[model samples]
Target: MRNLAEKPYVREEQREVQTVRRQIRKTFTRAEKGLLTLIGAAIVFSAILMVSNYASMYTQNQEISQLQNDISQQQQYNEGLEHQVSELSDPERILNIAEENGMELNEDNVRVLQP
Candidate 1:
């Protein structure tokens, strides 16, 4: 490696001097100024885009929370339905419904016919 003192300075300090010596002024024409304005607008637009992206994420998170709540309610509903089905599956309840529907239980030795 070269010594630190041997390293040449890549950055020039007197940018004004270089411009003056080269007779190149940093003057902006109307179109150039408008282009710079457009670049600034693009930067602001990107910031708005970042904020809107986060906002949409927040909205989706809220939706997911609501869906989770709905799922919990559905689980409770399913549990209630399971309890009702269990209650209705008792032998007495089955015989009651069958009698109401005009059906009879078949004995092992009985032969049944349908029309």
Candidate 2:
């Protein structure tokens, strides 16, 4: 009965020693803390890089959209100018303008060009 009582005390002491060892193991070393801090900083830098890249892409897209709109407007204005040119270049209108300027049409000197 006395030996059995001593065994329980010994077991309790062993348990306390193991608990203390586990606590000690849970604490971080200096090198491990530095490694963790480096990894955290790297993660933050990568996140900032991604956000900046996205912002740059967004700004470029807006510029491209604006350039496309300007090109479309210029194309429409060019089409309008082409239509006006065609109206002004009618053969009948040219003949009337020549007559109004006191010019005579001689068929012998007239040249008809085909496109």
Candidate 3:
């Protein structure tokens, strides 16, 4: 039969052992905590750097696309100007303009220039 009124006697040695066990249960040492903090900071920094690089690359790609569009438009404009030049430089158009301005063409005095 157990006596319920009497409290269990805990020895000082046992108490000390229990305290040690509680201390042992602590998950991380100070150095391990510092290392974990450093690792976490590094991961955050890497993420930020990667985002920054991606943004920069995206901006550059957009700029390149705009430049390509501009170049294509300019090329089309240049082709238009070239067509106009070719049309305006036709010998018949030139002769018509000259005759409208009361100029006579002398084939004997005309010289053709070769490129």
Candidate 4:
């Protein structure tokens, strides 16, 4: 059987221990708090870096797409100019234009140069 005289003393000691345990459980250690703060800061920094890189990549892709469109337009314009050049340089077209202007081609007036 337990000692009846020590029962109240043991109950008081148990209440004090429970109070200390509750206080300890309610507060974080300083090192643990610092570590948690550092982890949160790292997560925020990583998110910022990821967003910045994504924006940079998106801008570059848009520029590249615009440049490709410019190249396609320039190529089409160059092809049109090539067709005009071929038409303007045609011998039959040149002869018709000269005839309209009252110009004649004489075999005796033609001189050939050898390279």
The model with the greatest lDDT is: 3
Which sequence of candidate numbers ranks them by TM-score, best first?
Answer: 3, 2, 4, 1
TM, every model: 0.54, 0.75, 0.75, 0.67
- Of 3 and 4, the candidate ranking higher by lDDT: 3
Cα lDDT tens digits, model 2, 47-88, are 999999999999999999999999999999999999999999
lDDT of 4 by residue, 5-104 (tens): 6655533444443434444456889999999999999999999999999999999999999999999999999999999999999979998999999999
- Number of clashing pairs, model 1? 0
Scored against the true structure, residue 96 in model 3 reaches a CA lDDT of 100
Candidate 1: what lDDT?
A: 0.91
Give the lDDT of residue 89 in candidate 1.
81
Please give the RMSD to the true structure for each candidate, in Å.
14.0, 8.0, 10.2, 9.7
Candidate 1: regions farther than 4 A off: 1-26, 92-115
After the best TM-score superposition of candidate 2, give how far the Cα of residue 26 lies from its true spot, in angstroms. 1.2
Residue pairs with colliding backbones in model 4 are none
Clashing pairs in 2: none
Q: Which residue ranges in model 2 land beyond 4 Å of their true spot?
A: 1-25, 113-115
